[model samples]
Target: VAQHRANVRLWWTRSSLKEHTAGLSNANIPLFFPKLECIDNANQSHLHRLEAVVAAKCVRPGASLRSIGAADVRGLCGGWLYFRQRGGSPAGATFCKEGTCRMGCTSSAEERAALARSKQIEKNLKEDGIQAAKDIKLLLLGAGESGKSTIVKQMKIIHESGFTPEDHKQYRPVVYSNTIQSLVAILRSMPNLGISYGNNEREIDGKMVFDVIQRMEDTEPFSEELLAAMKRLWTDSGVQECFGRSNEYQLNDSAKYFLDDLDRLGAKDYQPTEQDILRTRVKTTGIVEVHFSFKNLNFKLFDVGGQRSERKKWIHCFEDVTAIIFCVAMSEYDQVLHEDETTNRMQESLKLFDSICNNKWFTDTSIILFLNKKDLFEDKIRKSPLTICFPEYAGAQEYGEAAAYIQAQFEAKNKSTTKEIYCHMTCATDTHNIQFVFDAVTDVIIANNLRNCGLY
Candidate 1:
C-alpha cells in the first residue's frame, strides 16, 4: 500500500533489507520512498528507512544517463550526490535530511559511507582538461592593416593542414572586445579584496573563494545573482579595462569605449555618440602574444595605438606581457609625410619609443622593433645607414641626413640624444623574417626569466 501525507513526519529508522524484507520482492510492488542514500537487499525490517542519501536528480531525457540502470544507480548512490550548474540558479543547498520512504529497510543510526568512485572520475576529468592546454610561449603584436591576423591564421592552418607548399591563401583573423568585464573578473579573483563599507566608504575586506561556491546548494539559500555574475566573469574573456585610467574603472562597454577612445583622441572640440561607436573600426590592431600556465589564464588585451594621444596607453600593456613588441610602421617619408597629420603620427612613435625605453618594464622586457611593410622599400636597403629617406631610399635622402635633421630638431629643443636606436625591417608576410623577431624575444627572455613577475 502507498502512504502519502505531508504531515506524516517519516523518520527513517535504519534497517537492513535482507534481514527485514523477507520474501517481499520488488516484482510484487515497486515502492517509492523518501530520499535514500544507500539501499541494501539484506534486510526488510522497516519499510522505507533512510540513513542518508542524495535526492533523485533529473537528467535530460535520452541523455547518456538513460543507459545507466539499477546497477549504475546503486553504484552512484551516495549521501553527497551533486548536481551541475550548467545553467540556472541552484537557489540553495542541503547535505543531510530526515525523510521517509516505503518498503523493507534496515534500522539504527550510523553515518553512511560516501561514494568514492564517481567523485574520483570527476576529479580525473578536470585534471585531463587542464593538461590539454598548449604550453607555447608567444608574442602577439600587430596593427589593424598589418598582416598579424594573417600570421596567426598561417600558423593555425599550417599545423592543421600539415604545411602545403603548392598553394597557400594569405590568412586573416578579426579580433575585437570590450574592457570593464575583463578588469572586474581579474580583480574579483584576488584574495582579501577591498570593498567600500557603508556611507562612510571605509574600505573593508570582502573576498570569497571558488571552493566555497562549489560547496553551495539551492535549498540552503544563497544569492543567485551573485553566483551567476561570478560564473559569467570566469567564462567570458572579451570584456576589457584600462589600468592607465585612474583608480575607478568603468563597467559599461559603450561608456568604456567612448572614454578610452575619447581620451586617446583628446578631443575637446566635439562630443562623441553611440553612432560613433557603431562606426568605430580600429585603424590599427595591436597583438601581443602573452602565454601563461596558471590554471585558466585567458587574456583579454586592449589595443593601445602609437598615436601621440594614445601613446600613454601602452604603459598599461607593459605590466601584462610575456614579451613586448614595438611596431614601426613602414611608410615613405615623402609619401606618408604628405600631410602634417602623418608627421604627427611619426613623431608620436618616436616619443613612444623614448617613453618605453625609460619605463621600468623596459629593462625586463624582451623587445622586438618590428619595422613592418618592408616589401614597399627597396630590398637592397636592408640595414638602415646614417642616411636615407625615413622609410624609402630609391634616390631618397640618406639615413644620416634624415637622422641629422631629426637630431637637429631635438637640439633645437635642447634635448639632443647620442645613442642610436636599432630598428629591424620586416615584411609582416615573411614568416622567416618574423621568426627572427620571435627568436630575438626568446633570447631576451632567457637573459631575464620573468614567468611569475606579477604586478607591483
Candidate 2:
C-alpha cells in the first residue's frame, strides 16, 4: 500500500506539484475516501481526477512544464495530498506546529516552463488568425471545357494531397457517362462519315460492328453481351480507322483511353483509379470554390461555367479576386460550342476573354492566360488546318507556329495594359505540368501582391 502512495507521489512530483503531504498516508486513506472500495480504488480515483484537472488547466492549454505554476499543479493533484492550517507557520510546510497546518506551494522550474509554452501557443494562434484574414482569392475565368475545373482538381491533388478514396469512387458514374457520350457521338457521326451498317460496301465487318454499336446503345443492364458488342466495335479495324480520324467527328479527348478499357470499366463492381478520375469529363454548370494552402499561401480558386448563359453569374463572384486564370481551350479552334453550334468555340472563348479583360471591376486584377490542352492542340493542329478557324493566321501548319499566333492575338486584344498578361502553354490533366506551372504562378502572384502593397 505504501508502494502505491510512493507511485502517486512520483506522479504528482513529475506533475510539478509542490504541496506538502504530512497527514497524507496509506493508513489514513479511510479518512478522506469513505466511499472508495479499497486503497487501490481510492488511489485510482485520485490519479484519474488529478489527470483530468491537469489536462484541463495546463496540459491541454499547450503549457510547458516550466510555465505551469506550482500552486496550480498542486491544486490539480491536491486530492492525494492533504493540507491543514498550522498556527503561525508557513501554509505549505511539511511538518505541523501545534496540530495546525497551512496550504502553501512554491513555483517549480517545470511550472515556469509550462508558462513559457502557454505564451508561445497564444502567439502562434494570433499569427494564424492574421494569416487567415490575409487569404488570397483567385478566380478561374474560362469558357466551358477550358481546363478550369481540371486546374482546380490539380490544386486539390497538389495541396490537399490528392482526393480521398471516397472522392475517387464518386467518379465511377461520371466515367461511365463520358464513355456512353463519346460512343454516342461516334455512332451519330458514322452516317456523316459515309460509313453505316446500311452502306459502306468496301468494309462488310465495319458495317456489322457499326450496327452493333447502335444496338448496344439501347441494351439495358450494360450486360456482358453489351460489353462484348462494344469491344467488338472498338477493336474493329475499320472503326479504329474512323476513331484515328478524330477531327472528322466531335469526340472527347478521353474517348480513346476509355474505349481501350471497356472490359474493366464496364464491370459492375468497378472502382475508378486516380488517372481515370483525372481524365473523366464532367461539364461544370455553376461555380465551384476550392480552398487550399500552398507554400504557406492560402488560395481560394473559383471555377465557373464558360457558356453565355452562365457568364451572368461570373460578374457576381469577381469582387476582391487576387488574380484571374483565364483558360483557353487551345484544341477547340475548329470545333463549335455545344451551347451555340453556329459559333466556333475558340471564337466564343476569345470574345469572353476580351469582355473579362475590359471589365472595369477587374482593371487591377492580374490576368494569367493559360493556353490549355497542349496535347490535344498538337494533335488537332496536325489533323485540322488553323486556317479553317482564323483565315488570317498566316503561320506554317505547325504546333509552335499556330500556338504563337494564337497567343499573340490574345495578348494584342487584352485591354489591361496596367498588368502584363502572363501566358503559359499547359496541359491541366498532367499533374507534374500543373505543379510546375502553379509554382511559377504563385511566385507571380506573390510578387504582384508585394508590388501593389508597396504602391499603397
Candidate 3:
C-alpha cells in the first residue's frame, strides 16, 4: 500500500513537471539541461524504484522528494530556455545558483525584451503601409498620342535620375524607326492629297523611301542609300506642302522635327539625345508606372494607353487613385482620330474627358486638365482654325484667345458641381515647361490629398 502511495506521488510529480514545461517547449525555447531522459528511464514496474530514481536524478542533492516542487525541476531544465529566449546559446549560458538549484530560473525580462522588439517591427511595418497608402497616385489619361508618355519621360528627366547612356542607346532604334515611319506616312499621304514631289526628278527617291519602309524591319538601321533618298524627298517643296497639310491626315507630331535632322540622325554612331527621346513616338499599350520622390512626398504616376482598344485595360488601375491628369493635344483641334477618321480628335478627347471627369469610379477624385502641345497648337492656329473642332467658336485664331476657347470647351464637359477642374497649358516635349508645370501640379496634388485626409 505504501509503495502504491509513493507511485501515486511520483506520477503526480511527473505530471506537474510536464504541465509546466509544455509551455516553454511549445514556445520554441530549448530545454538543454537537467535532461528529462532520467525520468523516462525510471522503472515503471516497481513504483518505489521509479520514485527513488526521480528523487535521486532530478532533485538537488540533499533535497527531499516531497520538498522539491515542479518549479525546482523546471529551474534546472529551463535555464537554457531562459538563456535562449534572451538570445543566448546553451554553450554561452552562465550557470548560477538560484534559491535551491544550481540552474537558473526563467526571467520575465527576456520575454519582455523579445516582445518589445517584435512590437517595434510590427509598428514600423504599419507605418510603412500607412505612408504607402498616403503616396500621391496620379493617373495619366488622354487621347492616343496626346503626349501622355512624353510627360512621363519628362518626369524621369526632372525628378528621377535622368536616362543613362545605355538608355540613350536603347532609344536610338526607336528614334530611327519613328523618323522612317513619319516619312513613309508623309509619302503615302501625298498621292491621297493630290500633291506631287516638288522635284519630278526625285519621284524615284520617294519610291525608294516607300520600298525601304516596306522591306526593312524596325530593328534594321537605315542604310546610307535609304537615308539619302529620304533626305531628297523631305527637301521637295511639294512634299513640304503635303506635310503642311499633315493635320488632314494622321501624321506623327514629331515627324517634322526628325525629318529636319536626318543628317545627324542617320550617322553610323548616332545616339539619341534627350530631346529625341522625348519626341520619339512609341504607343503606350498597357499601364506603365513611374515612381519618384518630390518635395519629401512619394509619387506613383500611372500612364495607361489612350487608344480605343487600350482603354479597356485601364479599369484595372482605377482603384485608389489620388488624382487624374487628363491630357488633350490642343494642337490636334483640326485633326481627326486615327482610329475613326470621321470623328474629330479634339472632340474625341472632350468626349473621353467628359466620361472620365464624371465617371462614378472617379467621383471624389481630383481632375487636372493638361492642355498639352501648346507649341504645336500655337503654330497650327496660325494656319488652321479652332472652328474645325468647335463650330461655335467666334474668337480670333491667336494663341491666347484660341487656347482659352479650347480650355473652355473642355471645362464645359464637367457636369459635376462639386468637382473642380484644374487646368494647365503644357508643352510635353519641353523639359523646362514640364518641370515647372509638374511642380505646380505637385502642389495641387498635395493640397488635394491633404484636404481629402481632412488635414485642412
Candidate 4:
C-alpha cells in the first residue's frame, strides 16, 4: 500500500498539474458531457477488429515527455502496456505512453516507452522550452450499454488529476440509459427540441416539446430497431418530416432553408450505397463529449460509432486527435455466435474491422484497442475453462482462455503488426483496476511522442 501511494504521488509530481488550469477559463463551456444514451440492445462487436482499427487513428504531433503525461508515476505493473497498430487513417504511427504516466505498470514494453519518453521530454524542454497550448477534443463513441458513460466517469475521477470526488460524479454528469433511438426519437418526435446550425446544443420550443420530454421521462430501454422505426416516420425522400409535408402554420426563408439541410444534420447515414459502412449495419456516429486531463492538459474525447457510415463523418473532428481508444464489446460475440438475433454484432464489428485495415482514412493513424466489458463474464454464464495457459492471467487463465479464444477472431491485418497490441479483459464497470486503463492509455500516448522525438 505504501509503495502504491508512493507511486501515485510520484506520477502526480511529474504531471506537474497547473497551479491554475491554463486553457480553460471560468467562462468557457463549464465541463459539458453529451446526452446519456439508453440503448436497450446496443451492437456489440465480439471481434476485436474495431480495436485495431480505432488505434490506428491517433495523431500525436508533439514528441516530448512534457507532452505526454506518462513519465511521472512509479510502481507500474500489470494490464495493457502499449499498442502497435497498422494501416488506417492519417496521423503518426504508434499510439503509446510510458514513464511515471505508466504508473503501476509492470509491462516491459510500456516501461521502455516510459523511459524513452522521459528522455525525449528532457531533451525537448531543455532546447526549445515550452510553448502555447491548445485543448484536444476527443469523441467518445460506442454502442449503448457499452459503458461509455462509465468509462467517461472513471476517466474524470482517475485521469483528470485534480477533480474531486464530487467532480468525478458530475463527469458523465448523470447516469442514464444511453441509446441512439431514444435520443433521436425525442428530437424527431419533438421537433421543437432542435438545435442551432453547427453545434450539439439543443433547444426546446412549442407545447408539443414539453409533452414529448415528459413522455421520454419513462426511462424505458430503447433500441436501434426503435430508432429505425422512428426514422421511417421522420424521413420521406431524404427530407425532414417535422413540418408535416411542409404544411406548417408558417416558415421563414431561413427556416425553409434549414429544413433542406436539417434531415442530414448529425445524421451521418442519410443514404445507403454499396460499400457504405454504417448503413450496412448500425447507421450513425454515436459519439458524445468526453473530457479528461493528463499532466493538467485536457483531452476531450469523441469516440465515433464503429459502424461504417459513421467513419466517413469522423474526419470532421479527426483534425488533431492526441490519442484514439478503439473498443470491442464482448457481447458482440454472443449476439452473433448464439444465432438468437438477426443482426450479428460480431459480423458488423468484423466488417468495420475489414474497412479499417483496408481504408485509406487510417493510412497514417495510430491508436489503442480496448477489450471492454470483462465484467460481463464475471458471472457463471461466461466463466473460463478449468485449464488454460497464460502467465499474466495466472490463476485466472481459465478465464483468460476465453479472451485468447475471442482475440483470434479479430486479429489485425498488418503482417508486422509491430505496434504492440495489449489485450485486457476490462469490465468497463470502472471498478477496481480501473485506473490501470488510463495508465495504459497515457503510456501509449507517451510512447508515440518519444518515437516522434527519436528518443526511442
Q: Report lDDT per candidate.
A: 0.34, 0.66, 0.72, 0.38
What's the TM for model 4? 0.41
The parts of candidate 1 lying over 4 Å away from their true place are 1-314, 337-345, 379-423, 450-456
lDDT of 1: 0.34
Better of 2 and 3 by TM-score: 3
Worst 10 residues of 1 by lDDT: 168-177
**Backbone N/Cα/C clashes per model:** 51, 24, 0, 65
Runs of candidate 3 exceeding 4 Å displacement? 1-134, 306-317
lDDT of 3 by residue, 152-171 (tens): 99999999899999999899
Q: Which stretches of candidate 2 lie over 4 Å from their true place?
A: 1-134, 197-222, 267-269, 313-316
Q: Which candidate number would show the highest TM-score if scored against the true structure?
A: 3
TM-score of 2: 0.65
Q: Global CA lDDT of candidate 4, please?
A: 0.38
**Model 4 lDDT, residue 440, Cα:** 62
Question: How would you order the candidates by TM-score, starting with the best?
Answer: 3, 2, 4, 1
**Model 1 deviation from native, Cα RMSD in Å:** 28.0
The digit string of per-residue lDDT tens for model 1 on 1-456 reads: 122222112322333322223343323112322323222333222112211111111211221212222322233322322212224222332333432121221212321211233344334433432332222234444333334433443343322342333222111010012222333433453322343222221111112323333454311222444334433433332222222221132122223343344233232332223233222223443433322222233322233432434645655545535444555444332222213423433354455555664456444444445555555334223333323333342334444344344434322322324322334556555556655654454444433332322101
